[model samples]
Target: MSKDVWVIIEHQDGAPKKISLELLGRARELAETLGGTVVAFVPGAGVSNVAESLGSRGADIVYAADHALLQPYTADAYAQAVSQALQAEQPTLVLVGSTAQGRDYAPRVAARLGAGIVTDCASLEVADGHLVATRPMYTRKTIGTVVFSSGGIRIAVVLPAVYSVPPAEAGRRAEIRAFQVALDSKGVRTQVREVRAIQRETVPLTEADVIVSGGRGLKGPENFALLDALAKALGAAVGSSRPPVDSGWVSHDYEIGQTGKTVSPQVYLACGISGAPQHLAGMSGAKYIVAINKDSNAPIFQLADLGIVGDLFEIVPKLTEAIRQAKGRA
Candidate 1:
């Protein structure tokens, strides 16, 4: 019987991605409840150190595939490697982060293995020795629980920042298995020509404890400078709604909505944003929400813990100044 739980580890520049560790934590819990072992799969160039770290984060085994062909993310290569590994180990459930890379590769891997694939899962549970996944539907107004009956294995692509990372334990031992790579040069349709990583001053939106988001109500793209100033003063990350992203005012990576990143920060400050259901679905898990908008009837106010009715242009600057003073940085 398929019994082990496997989490695919994602990394860049030799450092593990935060969501990969979070997956390990959640997988560990599920494995414990199901009386199974938790394993991790890391595919890249020279990723043994990353595999070691996964062991410290509750993985019973680490499958490392370090090869030149696996240097950059290619859907075919990843699918081939993971599919082969799954055939060898026969894990009952496999978890992947719902990031862009996983969004592309998870379905391919599931198809190759003839398994069930559930995307953008917000919650996971083990019921009747099967993995049941829950994801939002109807623009986040409702949730649907999916139970896989594929028999071979179940796969889930989890949203980032929805789950917390487990504590790392030092000196944890894991069986490290070196997997062989099977690359089909003919099947590799796309080649990565270049990789340009964005260097920004603020923390990543998915990892930030506090987030300050804005929308079309800011009026213009240049006005985002004020939003940045407030975010810097509050030591928070800046996020945007779909309108801003669709308007090309901000990069898609900075967008927080059903179509973008899902963040559950300790505090979410929405300024000049009309809370479309899509945007709220991404940030509703925030511990506290504060909305600042000129229209008192904005949908955002309904979900906010504190709602301020005023012109954001006039209010944001004063709020930024006040926060700076409170921090003694004025």
Candidate 2:
């Protein structure tokens, strides 16, 4: 078995992306157990300046493929680049973030090398000398563990925010090298015409350490304003169930459920949420779940770590005041 663990780095500027850093933390842990080294492979247009931080976050070596055509993420181009790196490096484990770009290209890279891959893996550890990944199944009704049966080299696409970002060690450094990718006719299948960047004003639920989500039981859209004070007190992001968004009370971006954004925060405050399977599928990965609703028989009580049976109007304001006073925020 190859003793080198590799992570594909994705970034635009000199800094590494959030998911890249998170995977590096996991790769570092895995490499230590195997007595191996961690390598970061960056394939894009002009990413040489991004190598140093990657090393500080636990990469032993930084291999970059800086080419002109690699700017806007194209699956064929990136797959070709990653496939070349795999052929040359022969790392035991390859971890990629399950971002939109990663989801598009990881499968292609696996196909190029005829390797098996698992997507959205939640956790991984060395078990019986093999890496075992744990994730949810049955819409999170159960946990499923996965292992690569073909079992030579493993490729895994990790969910974002599943792992915390690795702390950077300022003094650490890495030996840097560049990999070359040659794109032929087949590799240049699609041309990206434009890339639009959407700048939403709200905190992204995926990145929030704490989230406060309200459902239809909040009564109407206007009543959701009651949550704003509590969310502010806790320094948490505001989210909603589908009803508010469908009712046009809140924007669709704030919706959290199967049809909306999946979130895994440290603290999930589900106020007035009924805990539908679709809603649970999104936030079930949260470390702590607190549900506040008037109905003690609510389905949310089944999943909440702490259940508060009271009217949110009364409970939320008092809770907000308590948090503010406790924090000495006045």
Candidate 3:
């Protein structure tokens, strides 16, 4: 009777993505509340180990779809595999991380399965036997809670870093089932020629506990070195506004805004950024926000826990030095 919650896991280079575990934690909580089992769906080659890891986090069962054609992420292939799994398992709810891959895969799977899908949900809970999904709309100016009907099944794509990763339990056991699907490459438009990974330190913005972001206030790309140094001192990931990304000063992956990654880090430091509504929509979930800008009237200061009205050029270097000195004491 569709009594279990299923999660789709994403992996690269044989390693599971961090957001998958975070979604597992959320799914576990929901399953406990609804008195249902938490199941994980892993797709790709040699992913049985990753399926086991999902059990350690909280999955009650692991469904592994191992195929050579599934080695690389293709919308058609993944949708087909997940659709088959859903049809067989009859899960009441399906959860996926709203990462780049999930964004591409979840909708396709939902469309194929004829299931209702809610994307970029910040929070989820079961209310009166219905899954309630909370998501931002109108550029984060408004929040809406959606309740799906008792239709086929409910599927939700959640933003990364909105929830914490649950602790893994040693020696946890899950029933592992291997599944197979037929792939027809007919009419496939896109082909993967090569993949190049970006080298960076600290965690991904969505998974990072702390993020140090800069905006147009830094003046130009050359000044980003100061921001990077400060972020290093704080052991935080670096994020940028749309201007920096559009100017080619920073990679598009590092951009944080409405069209970019939505981060809920514990601490978000905005330097020289004006805090437009679009940008704030992505970072409003941060536990604490610190703004450093010369414009005291900047909208960013309205949401900041700590506001510094000064030239970022002068303030950033001093702050970096102070953090270095403080670290020395530790």
- TM for every model, in the order presented, reads 0.93, 0.90, 0.96
Write candidate 3's Cα lDDT for 21-41 as tens digits: 898888889989878999999
Q: What is candidate 1's TM-score against the reference?
A: 0.93
TM value for model 3: 0.96
State which candidate, 1 or 2, has the greater TM-score: 1
Kindly list the per-residue Cα lDDT of model 1 for residues 1-330, writing each as its tens digit. Answer: 567899999998677899998999999898888778998999988997888777788889888988777878899888888888887888888999988789999999988888888998989997886678888877678889988766878889998877898888888878998888777767778899999887778989988889999999998789999999999999999999998889989888889988888887989999999999989888887889999999999999989999999999999999999999999954
Question: How does each model score on lDDT?
Answer: 0.88, 0.86, 0.87
- For candidate 3, give the lDDT: 0.87
lDDT digits (tens) for residues 1-330 of candidate 2: 578999999886577788899999999999999888999998888788887668889899988888877777788888888888887778889999877688889999888898889877888888888788887777788888998777666899887789998678988998898777776646679999998764654466777899999998888888878888888888899999999899998888888877888788999999989999989978888999999999899999998999999998899989988999999955
Q: Point out the higher-scoring one by TM-score: 2 or 3.
A: 3
Candidate numbers, best lDDT first, in rank order: 1, 3, 2
Ranking by TM-score: 3, 1, 2
For model 2, the superposed segments whose C-alpha errors exceed 4 Å read 12-14, 184-190, 201-203
Error of 2 at 160 (Å): 3.0
Worst 10 residues of 2 by lDDT: 196-205
Clash totals, every prediction: 0, 0, 0
Best by TM-score: 3
* Candidate 3, residue 295: how far the Cα is off, in Å: 0.5
